[model samples]
Target: MSLRALPILFLFAAALTLTPISGLAAVGLAVGIAPPATVVETPPPPPPPPANVWAPGYWAWDGTKYVWVPGSYVVAPFPGAVWVAGHWVRGGHGWGWHDGHWR
Candidate 1:
């Protein structure tokens, strides 16, 4: 490479090596950088009937594209309880799913 291009090439190489994980903060920092907020398209269908407490659907990574999974009615863990909405959480390298549950 030409001398002028050598430094530019080195900068690009360093950038690649320094790229941080999606939720990671600065290197060696325990705090994680919050992921960019996601815009959910076509919100999950309305929760199932009262009998099946509705669990809000969330975006899930499916290898190639983000897919929406329809929410379903679930039997409450106990009577007179409510269902907590599901959410996506940051894991070590990627996002993980926290399923809805009775609260």
Candidate 2:
């Protein structure tokens, strides 16, 4: 591998691979390859407290191929914020990721 690419690889290998920060989503994650289709998931039953919102899963590029991230419920950031699930968008370079956030 080229020396320039070494650091990028090291970052993924050292830390958690393909995983986004908890609650916070990645703003601009561009990848050369396109991600696979999103998996179809039947959301599990909501917990007793209706405070939590369901965040649907999407394909995550792990510096390589796509990986499936299952869906789950998350507590709202604030009183009335809605969960905006992450998604993939096509751009000139390739597919890019727009992570979910509270509205």
Using lDDT as the measure, the top candidate is 2
For 17-56, candidate 1 gives per-residue lDDT tens digits of: 8876644432232213343455444535664555666555
- Scored against the true structure, residue 76 in model 1 reaches a CA lDDT of 71
List candidate 2 stretches off by more than 4 Å.
Answer: 1-28, 46-48
Task: Tell me the spans in candidate 1 whose CA falls farther than 4 Å from its real position.
Answer: 1-50
Give each prediction's root-mean-square deviation over alpha carbons: 11.2, 8.0
**Shift in Å, residue 63, candidate 2:** 0.9
Query: Candidate 2, residues 1-103: lDDT per residue as tens digits?
Result: 8999999989978787656774444456678887777788887764536787878888887666788989888888788888988888999878888877888
TM-scores, all models, native as reference: 0.43, 0.67
TM-score of 2: 0.67
